[model samples]
Target: MEGELQRRVGRNLRAYRQERGLSQEAFADVLDVHRTYMGGLERGERNLTLRSLEKLAAQLELDPLELLTERRER
Candidate 1:
């Protein structure tokens, strides 16, 4: 369901954000979204729109597929 997809995207986003050394608030500011909304996004509680997805991908300088990719366990 969407919940699982959200969680996956959230985890990916978290990893990317951390790799870039951005705090939640700083990331939110860069994305032009509210901090609380960003938190919900990182928690996989928000329903993401195409526009939002593109924005996040653009900010991360990654392809949208990268954001959607689920990390696999060894």
Candidate 2:
């Protein structure tokens, strides 16, 4: 369950970032995080804290819950 949630967050983050036309390195710069750390997050290899999640959401102009919620296919 934990791993699944991590992957979900990763997928959502990647999708949202792509939607904004940002590369992982650029997004990491916007978030003031390391590029490697951003890569880890996008790969679902790192666990995210609530505060970090909120920060990421805020940077993306998204509600924090949106990061955790599963996106439906069109």
Q: Which candidate leads the pack in TM-score? A: 2
TM-scores of the candidates in the order shown: 0.85, 0.90
Task: Give per-residue CA lDDT, model 1, range 1-74, as digits (tens).
Answer: 74898888888877876877999999888878899998899999998998889988998788998888886642
Candidate 2 lDDT over 1-74, as tens digits, reads 65998899999988888987999999899888999999999999999999999999998889999999999864
Task: Kindly report which residue stretches of model 2 are placed more than 4 angstroms away from their true locations once superposed.
Answer: none
Write down the lDDT that model 2 would get: 0.91
Query: Candidate 1 at 53: error in angstroms?
Result: 0.6
Where does model 1 exceed 4 Å of error?
72-74
User: Top model by lDDT, which number?
Assistant: 2
- Candidate 1 TM-score, true structure as reference: 0.85
Distance (Å) between predicted and true CA of 43, model 1? 0.3
| Predictions: Cα RMSD each | 2.0, 1.2
- Show the lowest summed lDDT stretch of 10 residues, model 1: 65-74
